[model samples]
Every structure is written in structure tokens, then in C-alpha cells.
Target: MRRHRRAKIVATVGPASNTPEMLKRLFLAGVDTFRLNFSHGTHEDHAKVHAAIRALEAEMGRPIGILQDLQGPKIRVGTIRDGKITVAAGESIRFVLSGADGDKTAIPLPHPEIFAAVMPGHNLLIDDGRVRVAVTGLGDDYIDAKVVIGGTISNRKGVNLPDTVLELSPLTAKDRVDLAFGLELGVDWVAMSFVQKPADLLEARGLIGDRAGLMSKIEKPAALDRIDDIIRLSDSVMVARGDLGVEIPHEEVPGRQKELVRACRLAVKPVIVATQMLDSMVNAPTPTRAEASDVATAIYDGADAVMLSAESASGAFPVEAVEMMDRIIRSTEQHKLYRSIIDASDPGEEQTAPHAVAAAAADLAEVIHASTIVAYTSSGTTAARIARRRPAVPILAITPHAAVSRRLSLLWGAHSVLSADIHTYEEMVERALGFAKEEGFAKPNDQMVVVAGIPFAKAGTTNNLRVVQVEG
Candidate 1:
């Protein structure tokens, strides 16, 4: 069965809602995707969750996407010697970086790369910006910063440096191991955190090697700077607004989110708007009015998905959050503007063979007022190309591989059908059209546009297109 809504809900898995029974309830509540955060859980723990989800999939007889999120290069303060440091506002407190067992300073600077790259006048936010520090001077072994705004600093508080780029690789050692585990586990998607360049995506994709699609999280300022390149390199993109908001001006995040979503759509890659969506529902049963509007905006902005963080993972209301998200997705999609945005992507020029074939299929569907558009894709690429056009009719993507079927579950307007291998382009189209007709998804008189590739065309390469009428 195909999902009716477009804005898919991605619920995070956490300690509060990790049981198999709870996961099943979440699936029933309309969660299209499950986000397994690699930062918190052990590999064994994730393995258990993976098993449980697969069991649910077997029972329900439907595909559910699993996204593995890697913790990429997280910078935090070292241990505080006194365990706590209370500084009043306007009080000048010194932040010292020393190898002295972290016992002398109010907050020990653990990341030496941050100190080396930091210059005077740069601002450092600690504990989620509750405390602010301004670099005043650079020392031989340590960097000194004066507390411009001080608050009580605790152990291992989060540090945010907006101005300076730390000389660090996007993937940490832990991320590499986690990615390997995800590949072995056969997850549907892998989300790389703090991706700053296309090279980061290339490295991850090389490791993944088509086992799972790479999703770049736009959370760093450097990432925002190179978003076009990142979008081109990655299979999908996510607007990770949490750390992104901290890194950039708060007022600019909303615009950035829209821009990023549009860019991904033009590139024909699915984009997810994530972080703090339905966050207030973590404790409260009902979301704030503003939060509801935020979700609607994401849908209106043409995002393929909207994600939930603590709302479904550790919140008091996990199932309720999913249900609410489902309702909002359906409701927002009813708007006339929603379809406009979906159809607003940059259409490919009918020049290249693949582009010409994809465009012709879309055009034929529109000309014949077809009820269904069937695109036979081996790698789910040609189907995605057609989906980027956002034709008004439904897209039926037939593939032989089960992995490709599951991955297409996250793409917009694509209903994937797993079928036996067809040797020729005509056989692929006939199989797809026959399936659509046999399932009563389309009537006898319904028309459809069929797309495949020429002789010996590899998967993901489409060089043929045809318009066919379903025989009675």
C-alpha cells in the first residue's frame, strides 16, 4: 500500500522509546522513517533496533526507511576542574587552555584545533550560548578568552564557534566505524553530520558504495557556503536547523532552509527539514501554534520530508507526535500552493538522451491526461528524474531489486514495485503497466508514459521513452 501524504515524518529512536512494542506503535502512527542516531546508542543496541524494525516490516508487509545519523566532529569543552563555575554577568572571568589536568580553568578547552584557529575578537559560545567568551589574546600553548557574558558552566557543555572554521575532518574515527556498521546492517539512508564540502560526501559514498544513500546535514556555516557542491555530490540533503541556527544568525536560518530545499529539488535529490520540529511536544501533548506553522512552512517550501528529534525519541508523547505530524503533512498538502512548489523544480533540458527521455515521458503523461506514469528504473535514478518534474499524475517505479524498492520509499511521488527481471525495455514497460492494471491502480482506458534505457544501458541510465495505452 502506498502512503497518501507527501511530507514524510522521520521519528528519532531513543532510550525512552526503544522497545519493539513502542516501535510498532510508532509505525502504526504514520512514521514513514526511523532515524537511528549513532551518537547515543552502542552498535549492539542499534543492531537490536534494526532487528525489531525489520520484524515490524515483515509483519506489516511494507517498506520503512531507516536513516543512520553519524555524529561528525562534535566539539565540546573539556572537563571542568571544580565541576562548576558560576560567573555573574559583566564579571570578567578568564578561560584558560592548559594541560594542567583541567583543574585550573573555569571551562577547560579540550579541542586544541579550536584554539589554534581562533584569533582575537572571535566569539565563543559555551553551554548552548548561555555563556559567551571573547578571545582576547593567543598564548604559546593556550588561548585566553575573557568572559563577556558569564553564566554557570557545568561539565562538558557544548561549545559553538561561529566565526572560525576548525581544522578538523568532517568524519571522526567513530563515524567511520559507525558507517561500516550501518552498511553491514543494510540501512536505507546514512546522514553525515556537519558536511562542509562535496569531498566529505564523496568519501562517505565511497565507503558506503551504494549500500545506502548519503544524506548531507547542512548544520555548519562551511556547509552552507558550499551547499551547491554538496547537493550535487550527495544523494539527498537535510536542513539540520539545530547547530545550523547556532552557527549562523538565527534570523537567516528560515531563508537558508528554503534555499537549500529548492536547490535539492532542482538537483532531483530529496531534502529533509529537521531538528526541533515539534520539539515543544516533547512534554506538552499539543504543539504550539507557531510550531505547527513551522511544519506547514516546510511542506509549502517543497521539502520531501520533515523530521522529529526528541519529540518522538524521548518525549512524553511519541505516538501522538507522529500522528500530529501526519495530520499536518496531509493538511498542508491540501493547499494549492503546495502543488505549485512541487512542480516548480528546474526541468531538465530536452537535449541529452536521459534528460530528453525523462522530459518526453513527463510531457506524454500530461498530454494524454494519464492516470499513471510508469518508469522502469534499475537504480531508481530515472524514476527520480521524472519525479523531479513533479507531474500531476502518480509515478509508478518498477524495479527488480528489493533494496532499490525500499530506498525509493523516501522519494516524493514515487511508488516502487518489486518485480521479476525483464530483459528488454518493452518487457519492463509491459510488466509495470500490467502490474498497475492488475492491482486496479489504473483502469483499462488509462494511459501511461513508459521510460527505460537503450540496449545494454546500465542501471540509472535512461535512453528510451514511449507512450502506451493500457489495453482493456
Candidate 2:
């Protein structure tokens, strides 16, 4: 089934929507990608879900994307003597690097990396900034800080150091195991979290290679300074506004989100605006008006996709959330100002032969009012290049590799299908026309623009273009 809209929906699969029947319903409701969060589930839990998705994909005859989201290094407080302890504002608290239970006088923070990197003026956000403290003194094993905000500090609550960059890899011991397991399962995308700098992507890349698209999650404030480099190194990017929202000032989240989305578009890579898009839908069947606007805002900003976290993962109404997000995307794309905004935000143009060809194809399709623009891709590059132009016509991305087709599920304006590689130019035209009519992108008399590489089954050879008629 072809989706009427161009922007795709990514929904996290969790306890609320993991059943085979429910998964089918969610897919039919318009979920392009399913994120398997490794942070909360066991290996066994994820494998079953992965198998279910593959089975559904085979049954539905669509390439569905599976994203394995790794939980990076999490710095948390040690156990508390009582279940929780409350600290007052302006109170001096010493955080000792010990695993022992903590008391009011000294809070035990077991992570040495935090102690090593934190400076005297750095702010430490605990339990999601409910308890805020600024470092006033430091030692080899202790950090003395004045609590800026007073709240209860519970055992093992997460710690966020916004000002300090820890000398730690994004992949922890648990993440390594999870990565191997997800790779073995043949995941389509691996979303690495806690990415501080561009170098954070290198280690994950070494392990991932070309198996799956490596998507770096922008959750740290430091990543904002070198976003262009990070986008270049990454296969895709995700504006994970959860931890990101907590680490930076709340007022700056919106600007950062827009900045990250624009940077990804400039780099010609897919970007997903994630976290709290439909939060109220977690318990209700419908989303709040503000949440609806949030999803629309991302679409207006030309983000490739918008995501659902707890709304679809553990929410009471999972399918409803997906349908709401689907409706919002379709409505926003149909807005009168939507195209103008996207056209104005177009990253000028890339200076390359392939990009030139793609741009020419896009302009030709708009000029001739073609029904569809077909791109014969092997690595999905040809389709991505063309889709980046945001052509008025729908894109039919024909690829032989199932992996490539699945990954294209995240790109903007791409409706991908799997087919055998075509060797002859004439054969390519014949197959494209047949697909256009069969996929409902065109009628018998409608014209379609075809863009394909000269060397068949090769990547980065997107130079050929043709205008062809669909035969009955």
C-alpha cells in the first residue's frame, strides 16, 4: 500500500504494542520504522520483537525499518541509605566516588569519569534537573557542590553534567553486547546515544561498518558546536530532545531542534525529530493541540520523520497515537505555506555532478508536471539525492537490495520497493512504468521522469535521466 503523505512515522515498540496483531494494526496505522529500545528490555525480549517485525514485513510485502537504539554510558548516583534524601538550596553536599549507600552529608556517586571531568563551576543535573547543584570544590574522590535547586535525590537516579565532557566512549559494556545482538538480528538502523562530539561516531562505525545506517542521537550540548561534522560522519541523525532537553536550557531546545534538522537537510541525510511529540496520547486516545502542533512544526521544518516514544511504546492507546501523527503529517504537508517554507529552506545546492543531475531531474519533473519521479537506486543514494530537492512529484525508489529499500523508509518523499537489478536502460523504463501504474502513482496516459545510474547496480553513478510515458 502506498502512503499518500511523504513524511514517515517512527514508533517505538514496547509492552503496549508488541503483539503480532497489534504490530500489524500499528503498521497499517502508518508506522514506517519500529525502534527497539535496548535501554529497558532484555535480549530475549528484543529478539522476539525483531522476528515479529520481519514476519509482518513478509506478510505485508513492505520494507519496514528496525532501529536498535543503544543506551550509552549512564552516570547515576549510588544507593541511598534511605530510599531517598532531600537536599536544600544553598546546602553544601559532598559527592564521594564510592559505591556505598549515601546519607545527607555525603552522596555517593560511583562513576569516576564524572569526578575526573567536572570542574568547580559546572552544573550537575540530577533526576532530570529536579535537583540541581553547582560544583564549588573538587578532589580526587569527592565533589563539593552547592545545591541550586532543592529536591529529593533518590537512589541510582541519573546524573547529567551539562558543562563537562566525560572521557568515555558512547558504547558501554552493556551497549557492546546489545550491539552484537542487534547486528546479528540484521537491524536496519543503529541509533547511538550520548554522542558528545563527532569522534563518538567513529567507534560505532567501526563495529557497524555497512550492516546498518548509524544514526547519531544529539543528546549532549557539546554536539551542537560540531553538528555539521557529526552529520557528515553519520549515516543519519536524530534530535533526541529527551536528554537533550534536560541538558540544555529548556528555552533553547526549540532552536537546537531547528538547527539540527536544518543541518541534516544541508548534509543530505535523514533527520528524525523525536521525543514527546504526542505525549498526552500515552493515556488518552487523542493528543493535545500543542502536541499536534509540535509534530506539525517538525514537518514544517522539513524533518524527514517525527517519532513517538512513550506514546506508542508504553501508552494506553498506541494505534491511536500513530494515526494522529499520520493525520498531522498529511495535514501539515498540505498546508498552503508548507511548500514555500520548504522551498525557502532548501540548502541552496550541492556542487557535484550527481547533485546537478538530481536537481535537473527535480526541476524537469516540476516543469512538465510529471506524475512521478522514479529513481533506480542500489545503495539508496540516487533516491536520497533526488528526494533532498523536495520535488512536487512523488518519488518511487526502486532498489534491488532489501536493506537499501528498508533504509529508504526514513528518507523524505521516497516510496521504495524491492526489485531485481536492471542491466539494460530499456528494461529499466519498462519496469518503472509497470511499477508506477501498479503502485497507483500514475495512470495510463500520465508521464513519469526516470533517473538512474549508467552502470547498473553501482552506487554514486546517478547521471542518466529520461522522460517516459506509461503504456497501458
Candidate 3:
């Protein structure tokens, strides 16, 4: 189905939206991509969901994207005495590298990376920053800290070290296993979590190869420090605000999100604004007004996609949440000021052959008020460049590779359809007109801007641009 909006919606599958029936409903409601979060659910369960999504894709005759999200190196507090402990502000807490339960004086941390990495004056945020502590002393086995924000500390509460960079791989044993299974399942994208550096993506890229798009989750301050490099190494980026908010000051999250989205746009990569976009919908049938505005703000910032985490995975209103988000995006895009905002934040032109062609195509289409911009891409690179321009008209990207078509579903303004490889300029023009008409992007006498690589199918070459007109 054609979406009314440009930005894509990625919904995670879980208890609430696990059934094939529910999955179909979500697709109809506006989900362009399905995210299989490895943090929860068994491999078997995810396999079933993957199968269901493929079945739905076949029945619907639309290329759907699947993102395999790997849970990376999550550090949480170990079990506490009596299942919980209360430490007052300014209280001294000594964290030991043990697996046993403990009281306030000697809480078990059980993570050597933290002990090895954290230094004096580093801040440790626990339970999503509900309780905070500043490192005062560190020994080989213990981390002594003064409580800065005190609250009840429970067993396995997640810990966030905002001021320290832990020396650890983004992938763990569980993630490797999940990545293998997901690659075998033919997922379109693999999202790595807890990415702290550009080098962190090298391992994932080596493992993933060209099988799927590698996306780095931007939730760590260290990631922000090297975001351009991370974005350069990865195919896409995700603003994982839930964890990001805890790691950085809450006020900085929005600014960071805007900068990340704009940076990705400038780099011509898809960026997803994720986590709690419609958080209130998990319990309520509708979202809070602020949540709706949040989704719109991401769209205004030019994000390629926005994701639904718990809202769709375990919420009471999964379909409703998708519908609401879809409506929000459409409404925001149609807002009179939306185009102006997108134009104002435009990163300008990249001085290269492919980018020049894409920009010329966008410029020509707008000048003539064309019905659509048809990009004949084999590697999907040309289409992505066009999408980065935020063209006023819809982008009908025709690709010979179904995988490329599916992956393009995440790009803003791209409506990809798999077709046989075009052999000549005559064939290219004919197919562009045919597909544009068939997809309802144009009618007889309508104008279209077409672009492609000259040698074709060789990839990364976007040299040709043409203005084609529909004929009766």
C-alpha cells in the first residue's frame, strides 16, 4: 500500500502484535518496517514472526523491510540484599565485582569493564537515572562512589555511565547467535546497540558483509563524540532516546536528536528516531499530545523513520499507535510550514557526479511540477541520494534487486518496486513511464524526472538525468 507520508514507521513485534492477523493489520495501518528486537523473545519466536512478515509481504505484493535489532552489552546492577536497598543522598556505596547479593555498602557490580574503565569523578546512573552516583575512589575490585541522587535500588536495575567509556565490544555471545539467525532469515537491516565508536561497527560489518544494512544505535555520549565517523561506517543511524536520555541530560536529548538527524541527512543516510515516540499508548488507547508533537518534531527535523518500541510490542493499542503515528506524520508533512523547515535545514549539494545528478533531477522535477521522480537504480544508491533531497514529488525507485527494493522502504519519499534489469535507454524510458503510470504516480501528459547510472547495475554511478513525459 502507498503511504500518505514520506517518513517510515518501524514497529517492533512482541506479545501484543505477534499474531499474523495482527501483523497484517499493522502493515495496513502504516508499518513500513518490522523490527525484531533480540533483547527479548526467543530465536524460535522471532523466526515465527519473521515468517509471518514474509508471508504478509508476499500476500500484499509490497516490499517490506525487516530490522534485526541486537541487544548489545547492557550493564545492569546485580541482585541486591532483600531484592532492594535504599541509600540516602551523600551515602557512600561501594560496588564490588561479585555475583552475589549485597547491601548498600557492597553492591555487586559483576562487570569488569566498568571497574576497568571508570575513573574517579565518573558518574554512574542506575535505574534510568533515578539513582545517581559519582565515583570517588576505584580499586582493582571495587568502585566507591558517593550517591548524588538517591532512590530505591532494585536487583538488575540498568546502569548508565555517562562520563566513562567502557572498553567492550558492541556484540556479545548472544548477539552473534542472534545475528547469524537473523541473517539466515534474510532481514533487510541489522541494528547494533550500544555502539561507542566507529570501530565498533567494523566487526558488525565484517560479520554482516553485504547481506544487510548495518545501523548503529546512537544512545551513548561517546557515540555522539564520534557520530560522523559512526554514521560514515554504518548504513543508518537510530536515535535511541530512551537509553540516550538517561546517559545525557534530559534537556540535551532533543538537541542531540536534531543534530544526529541533520548529520545523517547531510551524509545521505537513513536515520530513525526511536524509543517512546508514543509511550503513553502502551497503557492508553491514545497518545499524549506531547507524544504526538514529539513524533512531528522528528519529522520536522527530517528523520527518515520513527520507531515504535514498547508502544507496539507490548502495548494495549498496537494498531492504534501505528495509525496515530501515521496520521501524525501525514499531518506534519502537510503542514504549510513543513516544507519550509525541510528546505531551510537543507544541507546543500554534494560536489560529486551522483549527487549532482540526483540534485538536478530534484530541481528539474520541481521546476516543471512533475508528478514523480523515477530513479532507475540497481544498487539503490542513486535513489537514496534523491531521497536525501526531500523532493516535493514522490520518488518511484525501480530496482531489479528485490533486496534493494525492500531496503529502500526505509528511505524517505522512496516507493521502490522490483523489476527486471533494464538493458537500454529505450527500455529505461518505457519502464519508467509504465511503472509511474501503473503505480498511480502520473497520468497521460504528466511530466516525470528520471535518473540512473550510465553503465547500469554497476552501482555508485548516477550520471544520467532526463525529463520524461507520459503519453496516451
- Which regions in candidate 1 have their CA more than 4 angstroms from the true location? 88-91, 100-106, 344-351, 438-440
**Position 408, candidate 1: lDDT:** 81
Estimate candidate 2's alpha-carbon lDDT, on a 0 to 1 scale. 0.93
lDDT of 1 at 68: 96
RMSD of 2: 0.9
Put the candidates in TM-score order, highest first: 3, 2, 1
Stronger candidate by lDDT (1 vs 2): 2
State TM-scores per candidate: 0.92, 0.99, 0.99
Candidate 2 lDDT at 296 equals: 96
**What's the TM for model 1?**
0.92
- Model 1 scores a C-alpha lDDT of 0.81
Better of 1 and 2 by TM-score: 2
TM-score of 3: 0.99
> Backbone clashes in each candidate structure, one number apiece?
0, 0, 0
lDDT of 2 by residue, 1-472 (tens): 9998989999999999988999999999999999999998899999999999999999999999999999999989988987799899999899999857788667999888888889999999999989999999999999999999999999889999999999989999999999999999999999999999989999999999999999999999988878888999999999999999999999999998888888888788999999999999999999899999999999989899999999989999999999999999999999999999999888878899999999999999999999999999999999999988888799999999999999999999999998999999889999999898889999987889999998888998999999998776
What range of 10 consecutive residues in model 2 has the weakest lDDT sum?
97-106
Worst window of 10 by summed lDDT in candidate 3: 97-106
